[model samples]
Target chain A: MYRYDEHDQRMLDERVRQYRGQTERFLRGELSEAEFRALRLRNGLYVQRLAPMLRIAIPYGMLASRQLRQLAHIARHFDKGYAHFTTRQNVQFNWPRLEEVPDILAELASVQMHSIQTSGNCIRNTTADQFSGVAPDEVEDARPYCELIRQWSTFHPEFNYLPRKFKIAVCGSVADRAVVRVHDIGLVIVRDAGGATGFEVIVGGGLGRTPMIGTTIREFLPAPELLGYLEAILRVYNQFGRRDHLFKSRIKILVKALGADEFRARVEREWETTRRTVPPLTAAQIERARSYFTAPPYEDIDAAACAGALAAARATSRAFDRWLQRNVGAHRVPGYAIVTLSLKRTGIAPGDVTDRQLELVADLADAYSFGEVRVTHEQNLVLADVPQPRLFELWEAVRAAGLATPNIGMLTDIICCPGGDLCSLANAKSIPVAEAIQRRFDDLDYLHDLGDIDLNISGCMNACGHHHVAQIGILGVDKKGEEFYQISLGGNQGTDAALGTILGPSFAQEDMPEVIGRILDLYVAERHGDESFLETYRRIGIEPFRKAVYGASH
Target chain B: MALLIRHGDIVADDWVRLDAEFDTAAPLPPGKLLVPLCLWNARRAELVARDQPVGIWLASSEHPEAIVDALEDIALVAIDFPVFSDGRGYSYARVLRDTWGFAGELRAIGDVQRDQIFLMKRCGFDSFQIRADRDPTDALAGLEEFSLVYQSATVDPLPPLLQREVRRGA
Candidate 1:
């Protein structure tokens, strides 16, 4: 993890003081509600349906054990003893009072964290692949670049009030775990023929009311010119992006209205001028950032001996074998394995973690992995470098904590949002729907057989849950004051990202489980060989699934 | 009276802002006048020939190119923010300063509140016409909101990382 220096700490302290003054002014009626909304939102405080929700930024989803413990403390003292991890890899406390938010921010600042740009119309917290430095298929470590971007975008004077909120994602691995294609700006670390690492810059990709796959504006942007290029894009957007209507504001709509070619030309022209005014990133800075993310010290273990011990454990416990197959991932190191502690246990909200669970995860991080944890975009915590020999002991401890659900990519591991139950923007409640679906697919063997289904649910078209890019997407719609779910098929968030097509009329809340069952039954019947749900859906297309769900009369 | 902050001081403002379109039926006002961009476009020669110094005020939607060639005669460039959140003026200020090299007074007008002064300063605005109801003295404190900034702007053109390194070296 990148440790904050005194400069960073000072900035956070100053921000806290500023926010506290703003909050006091609002309380004293010196500031109007509309005036205070912008200030509070920039600090990631949202007035929800029930109470104010405070979103704390976990920059690029990296948390040290001490920071995790601090989060648990905040959850216990300031909030409702639980926190919801969002799809963007940030965490939200749902019941914080507006008056206490500045204090919460002050606490977070103590741990080298603050919620600047986590919301509001600005460059938001830039996200990256959670498996950045430790993944086996990585071309380069993305954390260094992510840290560089984090510093550059924080409190950026020029882009503080963009036309709409902007999201930037970076991916360094062969696998697109960060869902880079559906962000406002996506940077994929790529190598040129000369083996020089640069970026494939994709702009204007987002999932909202209008979902879009980002177009590659620049095929290859040198790493040194990243911030300059970013500034150019933001400058063009700030000057020309639509402000007449809120829905027509995002950079995606601007890119769509002008077409990608003209947008690229404008950006290139702007870059030609803007790049000269800004200083380029230095080699020493890059090296300094990279130094923070170098591999942690690992004990040398005999590979064959460790393998034999793991085989004996797996042979003894079928439960351990199932967990190893589902929750554990292959790490780059010889004796280490990546462990994902599932937050998607049944009966709870998909991403909610109790304060106790938070402290337990912190302890687990200290015990099993290094004193670090990574929050995945799929709403799970990963111990990226757990040794193979300690897997069984870690599993038992995690299972006792009810986090070992063993459903990493299965149907029950649904990516959902805190919907109308908490969000004022949502049209319907999403947690009940996610819970209903989780209960319906409780059978482990059945879930494994279904295999690798990205079931995502959103409360509305805002697509906070990334419902647009799931294999099975359920979006809650408001139909004549009634809550209805509109199901879609064939959406994916992988390298080849695609939007799901709507499947006829939405079903009632009670019929959701049956509808999902019908879709899965059709998939199982139609699957060929070892075809996963996505492959089978693509092979057969949405026509058969639509017919299976809505019947073929129309 | 509307308060005007110039170079971190609340000074007497002699520049009069003309919000309405130019009327051929009426004579122009005396002293320095800041006319709207459209009015500047319509009567460019007339304004240039006048004895009083004239500046141009741009709406949030207006770009800096309209006044790039007109910078020689202009002593002030005023960018408007119809609302505090409409941020096009920040970019316009950068372009006016960094690209076209406008060396005169750059002012931010309309909805210029205390909270926005530091950023406006960074974007090359040396003068701020604070919102009519707000106190200019309180707004002046906004210039010191933070002693450090993280990105390159007109105030400090070096990359922040390099700036940090330079500070450490110093």
Candidate 2:
């Protein structure tokens, strides 16, 4: 994890004091409600439908044991004893008193964490792959560049007040776990023929009411010019993006309105000046950031004993075998595996974890894995360096703590947001639909047979849950004051990201479980010889699914 | 009295903001007159015929490139915010100062507030017209708001990283 030095600490301390003063002014009635609203939002404080919600930035989903413990302490004291992890790899506390927020921020600052720029119309917390450094197929470790951007973007006067909120994601692996294609700016680490690595910068991609996949602005931007090119893109966006309406304010609209080629020309013109005028990202600085993410010490594994124990355990315990299949991924280092702690157990909100469970995960990280954990964009936790020898023991501990469920990327493991139940922006509640679907597919064997699938639900067109890019996307819409869900199919989040197509008129909230079931049933029957849902959908297109959902009326 | 913040202090504003109907057929405001971009374009020869202290005010929608060739003719270039969150003025100010090298006073006008004055100054604004509802004197605190910035702005083209490289070379 990137520890805060003196400079980082001083900036955070200043922000805490700044927020404290702003709160005092608001309470003293010196500031208007509307003025206070924008300021509070900049600090990640949202006045929800029922209570105040505060989002805490996990900084590319990396956390240490001490920081997790601090989060647990804050949740128990200030919030409703639990915190919900968001799809952006941040955590949200739903019930905090408006007056106590300054105190909460001060507490967070003590542990090198604050909510600055988490919710504001600024360069937000840049996210990267959860399995960043240890992924077997990764081209470069993206955390160094992410950390560099994090330092450069924080309190940047030129970009802090963009026309609208901006999101930047970086991907270092061939497989895009960070959903690079759906961000305001996405960078894919690539090595050219000469073996020198640079970034392929993609711009104007976002998932709002207008979902767009970004165009490659600079096909190969050298790593040294990262900040310069970013400033150019943001500078272009800040000036030209639509400001008359909030819904059409994202950079995607501007990119589309001007056409991608013209937008690229404008960015090139701006980059020529900014690249020289602004400070450069030196090789020394890049190497300094890389020092923070070096691999932890490991013990040599006894392959004979490990194989014998694994074979014995598999024969004796079907449950263990199922968990091994679903919850583990290959690690670059031999004899170790990346373990995913499932936050998507049925009857619970997709990513809500209790304070005790947080502390338990922290303790488990200290015990079995390294003393750090990574949060995934899919709202799960990762123990990146867990030794294979300690798998059974770690599973036993997490399962006893109610943090283990053998669903990682299965049908029942749904991605959802706290919708109308909590958020004021949501047209309908999303958790119930997610819960109903989870209950409908309770049989683990049936789910495993269904193969890999991504089901995402959003409360509204804001697309906070990323429904626009799921294999089966469900968007909640309000029709004549009634809550209804519109289904979309064939959306994907990999390198070939595409927006899902709508099926027809929406169904009532109660009919969502059956609707999802029908879509899955059609997929299961039509798939040829163990094809994934996405593969089958891509092979046959949306005709069959559309006909199944809307019926044979046509 | 209408006021403008200049060099971190509030002072009486003497410039007259002419409506689009700035009677080109009649005498212009006796003192410095600030007119919209279209009006300036329509009456540029006459406005500069006297060449008495004159300024131009641009809406956020208007381009700063209009003044690229006439930097010396205008004494002040004011950019409009329209609303606090609409940040187009910052970019316009940068283009005026950094690109065009417009050494005249760069003022931020319309809907400007205390919270934004710091960044407005960073973008090369030398003057501000705080909205009538807010106190202009309170905005003086915004000038010295932050001791450091992560990226270079119009105020200082060399951010800390560049400054570090300079020091190493020295």
Candidate 3:
């Protein structure tokens, strides 16, 4: 984890003071509601349908144990006793009083965290692969570059107010866990023929009302010129991106309107001039950032002994075996594993963690991992360096904490948003639908047999839950004041990104469980020899699923 | 009185911002007149021939590139923000200062308020035309809101990393 220096701490402290002053002005009726709205939003405070929601940034989803404990403290004192982990790898407290937000921010600043750029029409928290350093398929660790961008983008003078909120994601693995293709800017760390690390830059990818897979703007941008090129792209968007209609203000609309080639030409032209004027990203600065993310000390445990113990533990308990198969992932270092603490257990809102759970995860991170944890974009916490031999003990602890659920990529593990139940922007409630579906697929054996599925639900077109990129996407739409869900199939988030196609007319909220079951039943019957839902959908197309769900009459 | 924030203090605004319907066919305003970009384009020769200072103000939609070739004659360039949330002026300010190398006054006009002035200053705006209703004196504090910045801007071209390194060495 990147430790805050005196400069970083000072900036956070100043920001807290500034926000406190702003809140006071608003409360004193010196600032208009509209004016206060923009200021508060940039600080990541939103007036939700019920109460104010403060989204605290978990920079690139990396958190130290102390910071997690601080978050738990904030939740216990200022907010409702729980927090919702957002699909962007950030956390949100739904019930904070607007007057006490500055206090919350001050508390967060003490632990080197704040809610800067977590919301609003500005450059937002830059996300990256949660498994960046530990992934076996990584070409290079992306946290250093992500940290560099995080600093550059934070309180960025020229780009603090863009046409719309901007999201940048970086990925260094062969598998795109960060969903790089669906971001405003996606930087894939790659080594060229000469073995020098640079980035393959993708621009204009986003999931909203207008879902777009980002276009390749620059095939290879040298690592040193990352900030310069980013500035050039942002400057062009800031100047020319649409501001007429709120929905059409994203950089994707501008890229689509101008066409990719012309947009690239404009960015190249701007970069040609601004590259020299903007301060360069030096190698020494990158090296300094890399120093923060270097591997933790590892014990030289015999791989054979670790495997033998793990195998013995798995042989005894079927539940442990299932948990290991679903929730555990390969770590680059031998005798270590990446463990995802499932927050998608049924009867709870997906990604909602109580204060006690937060503390437990923090304690677990300190005990098993290197006193740090990572948040995945799918709203799960990861202990990235868990030793293999400690798997049974960790699983036992997590199970006791009610965090161990053997449904990592199953239908029950739905990615959801805090929708109309909390958010004012949502057209319908999303949590209830996610809960209903989770209950429908509670059988673990049936889910495992069904194979890997990415079930994502969003309340509206904002796609906060990333419903557009899921293998099974359920979108809640309001039709004449009634809540209805529209189903879509075949969306994916990997390198070959594709938007899901709508099946048919929307279903009533009560029919959601059955609708999803019918869709899955079609997949189970039509699947060929352990083919996943996505693979089968890609092979047979949406016609079979659509016909199966809506019936043969249509 | 309309206030202008220049060099971190409130001062009398000397420049006259011409209305959209200002009579361009009539005589030009006396003293320093800030003409709209359209009028500047239509009466470039006449505006340049005048002895007094002539500046141009552009709408958020307009680009600074329109006056790239006329930087020598222009003493001040103002970018409009129609709305504070409409942020085209921030980038335009940078283009006018850093790219075009405009040495004279760079002013942010229209919808400029206290909260946004610090960033406006960083983007190379030396003067601000604060929205008519707000107090300019209070907005001055915004400039000193942060003594340090993470990224380099027109105010300080040295990157924060390099600046911090130098400070550490010192």
Candidate 4:
């Protein structure tokens, strides 16, 4: 985790005080509602249906135990006893008094975190792969570059007010866990023939009303010129991106309008002029940032201990053995296993971590693993450096905390956004719909048998829930202020990213879970044993699912 | 007709006679120049060296880095506020004075609303070229936009960074 130095601490502290004054002025009726809205959003405070929602920045999803504890404390005091971890790897508090947000921000500053640029039409928090440093497939850890971007994008003068919000995701490994394909700018760090790591830049991919896979604008940009190239791209987008219609105000629209070839030419022209003029990134600076992410110390432990644990799991718990096989992954160092704490329990909200659960996770991280944790964009927590022998013990502890569900890749594991029940922008309440589906299919055996299905829900066309890329997508649409849910099938979020097709006309709120159950039942009946939900759905188009969902009588 | 020399456009004042024929190929007509905000760039240095008309207009996208070098050669630099809410050009004009060594006439053009003049002038923009359709007198009041700026900027060089660092002593 990147610890804040004096300068970082000073900046956060000053920003908190400034926001506090702004909040005070707004409360005193000194600032108009419209004027205060932009400022409040910049500070990550949203006026939701029930109360103000404050999103705290978990920069690149990396958190120290101390920071985790601070978040737990804040969740306990200021908000409802829970917080929702978002797809962008941020944590949102559903209930916080508008006046008290500043105090919460002040506390966050004390722990080197603030919510600047978390929710504004500005350069947002740059995301990266959760398995950044430890992934064996990695060419180089992308965190250093992500941090560099974080520093540069924060309070940037020229790019503060863009046509629309910008998202940049960087992936260092061959496999794109960060969903690099569907970002405003995706940088894949790759090593060229000479073994020098650089970036393969992809531009204009986004998912709003229009979903697109980003096109590669720069095949291989040298690492030293990353910032300069990025500047060129932003400069082009800032100057020419559409502003006439709010719906069309994204870099993708500009790129589409210009045609990828023309857009690429313009970006190249800008880069040619500005590349050498920008401030040079030195080796020392790169090394200094990299030092912050250096691997933690590991002791040589007996492999026999891990074997003994596995033997015990085999002897006693078949479910635990299955979970260990599915949820655990390889670590960079020997004697350690990377453990994923699944947030997707059967009937609970996905990515919603209660205050008590947060404290427990923090405690688990400190005890059974290295004092570090990561939040995946898929809405799960990761104990990155758990020792192999402690895996079962950690699983036991997590199970006791109600965090272990053994459904990491199953149908019950859903990704949902706060819909009309909370968010002003949402057309319908997605949380209850997700909850309904989960509760309907609470049987672990049934869920496991259904196999690797991604169920994503969004309350509106905004697609904040990433409904477009789920195997089973549920989008909430409003028909004359009454909530109706639309279902989409066969979407995916991997190397092969595809938008799902709508099943049929929208269903009523109560009918959603039943419809989803029918679709799942169809998949189970039609699927070849080894076929995943997406594979099975692709083999037989949306017609079968639609027919099953709507019924032949209709 | 007042012929404007944009930042990157060549000044052709000497070679081609505007009265007789306008040569699009050659640089912008030299002499006293009026430039649009859209054309300011590195090419300004060449125009400045030629001692053509000495006015530079800043585009809305133009940052402080664009005109930091040409401030000495040009007699006047005008900043365009493409949109009324766009405060970027204001910051650039301020940086021209404090950060870079720009000392000549500073003008505001484009969407120069009535409410922005005060802050524009406070930020060191002296001259106001209100849009052709807008009322200049009303727009001139825009110079008095903000009465107080809590944080210092390029116009007001000292931020809290240089201020006393709150020392606690006995």
Here, model 2's chain A TM-score works out at 0.98
Cα lDDT of model 4 by residue, A90-133, tens digit: 99998999889888998999889899989877788899899888
Please name the candidate that would achieve the greatest DockQ relative to the true structure.
3
Query: Per-residue lDDT of A68-136 in model 2, one digit per residue for the tens?
Result: 999999989998789999999799999999999999999999999889888978888999999999999
Pick by TM-score: 3 or 4, better one: 3
For candidate 2, give the lDDT: 0.86
Sort the predicted structures by lDDT, highest score first.
Answer: 3, 1, 2, 4
Q: Which stretches of candidate 2 lie over 4 Å from their true place?
A: A302-305, B49-51, B161-170
Q: Which stretches of candidate 1 lie over 4 Å from their true place?
A: B159-170
True contacts preserved, each candidate? 0.52, 0.39, 0.58, 0.00
> Which residue pairs of candidate 3 clash?
none
lDDT of 3 by residue, A1-554 (tens): 78888889998999999999999999999999999999999999998898889998998999999999998999999987899899998999999999999999999999999999998999899899999899999999999899989988988999988989999999999889889999999999988899988999999999989999999998888888999999999999999999889999999999999999999999998897679877677767877788788899988777889989888889999999999999999898899999999999999999999999999999999999999999988999999999998999999999999899999988888999998999999999999999998888888899999879999999999999899999989898999998988988899998888899998899999999998899999999999998889999999999998789889975
* C-alpha lDDT of residue A93 in model 1: 93
Worst 10 residues of 2 chain B by lDDT: B161-170
Q: Higher DockQ: candidate 3 or 4?
A: 3
For residue A433, model 3's alpha carbon misses the true position, in angstroms, by: 1.0
| Displacement of the residue B131 alpha carbon in candidate 1, Å | 0.1
Scored against the true structure, residue A240 in model 2 reaches a CA lDDT of 86
Chain A only TM-scores, each candidate in turn: 0.99, 0.98, 0.99, 0.96
Choose 2 or 3, whichever is better by lDDT: 3
